[model samples]
Target: MARVIALVIVLPVRLVWDALGYCLKQLWRWVLAPIGRALGWLIHHLIVIPLRFLWEWVFVPVGRALWWVIDLLVVTPLKWLWGWVLFPVLKALWWVVDLLVVTPLGWLWRYVLAPVGRAVGAALAWAWDVAGRISRAVGRALGWVLWNLIGRPLAWTYRVILTPVGHWLRTWVWAPVASVARAVRAAAREVRVALFGGPR
Candidate 1:
């Protein structure tokens, strides 16, 4: 009795629940799925494709044109300033510096300082040679005067007069002194032997 009653109660509820699940599944598969696919296709074609095309074609070309305008107006003028105006001005300044400062200094060094220095050196060398010659001549004159005046007289006195005088003194005075000394020594020996013994 209880089993029949439970079946009668649960059977309609389970059938209704199954039917609702089938309807929901079919709606999702047929209606909602196709609508979602269509929405995706429309968003891709209308919004995404148009935006990509606009970015590639319109916006990119406009940006390139703006860049070209800036390059032409601003950058080209700056290039011309450096190339045509400022570069030539700097070159002219370098030329002026070379002309006024460098050229004169080079000329002064090459012409004035070099020649003057060479002339001064030559004059000094010539003066040195003349002074050396004068000194040599004075020395020769002094040597000639000394040899004739003092050295010749001294040589003559030593050779002729002093040599004979020294020989005469040695023969006369030295011989007598040596003889007297020998005689005295012999007499003293004889007296010493007479006072002491003959041999000890």
Candidate 2:
């Protein structure tokens, strides 16, 4: 009786549990798993594949074509223009400047300014020579005056006054001092000879 009662109670609960499990499995298999797989496939095909194709076929080629066009149209032309037109134009402008401005300036310097400068230099040289001659003449005159007035008087005073005074000092003062020094030296030598008994 107890086993029959337990079976009656547990059988309905187990059946309900199994029915719930079955419903979960059916929902996962039919709905959720299919939706997830479909979403993955759609993302791969629509977004990833198309983006890859476009990148490989469209974008890379388009970028390369743009680079080629830029090289052909812009870069090449600019290089050519710089090499052919602009460089030649600059060279011609420089030549024109040399011909028009520099050459004329050089000619002017050579013909007009140079001759004027030479003439001015010659005049300055002549003036310098004349000034030098005048300075020499003044110097000579001053020298002549100095010789007659100052030099001659100095010479005469040296000859008459200073020479006589020097001669008197030499004769009176120097001669007596020299005689006294010789006498003292002789006395010293005689005393030394007497004391030491050596030849005088």
Which candidate leads the pack in TM-score? 2
lDDT of 1 by residue, 1-200 (tens): 99999999999999999999999999999999999999999999999999999999999999999999999999999999999999999999999999999999999999999999999999999999999999999999999999899999999999999988888888998888888989999888889888985676
lDDT of each: 0.96, 0.99
The worst-scoring run of ten residues by lDDT in candidate 1 lies at 191-200
- Give me the candidate number with maximum lDDT: 2
Which residue ranges in model 1 land beyond 4 Å of their true spot? 1-103, 178-200
lDDT of 2 at 195: 91
Q: Give candidates' CA RMSD values in order.
A: 27.1, 22.9
Report how far off residue 7 is in candidate 1 (Å). Answer: 99
| Candidate 1 residue-wise lDDT at 116 | 98
List the candidates' TM-scores in order.
Answer: 0.41, 0.51
Model 1, position 99, has a per-residue lDDT of 100
**What would you estimate as the lDDT of candidate 2?**
0.99
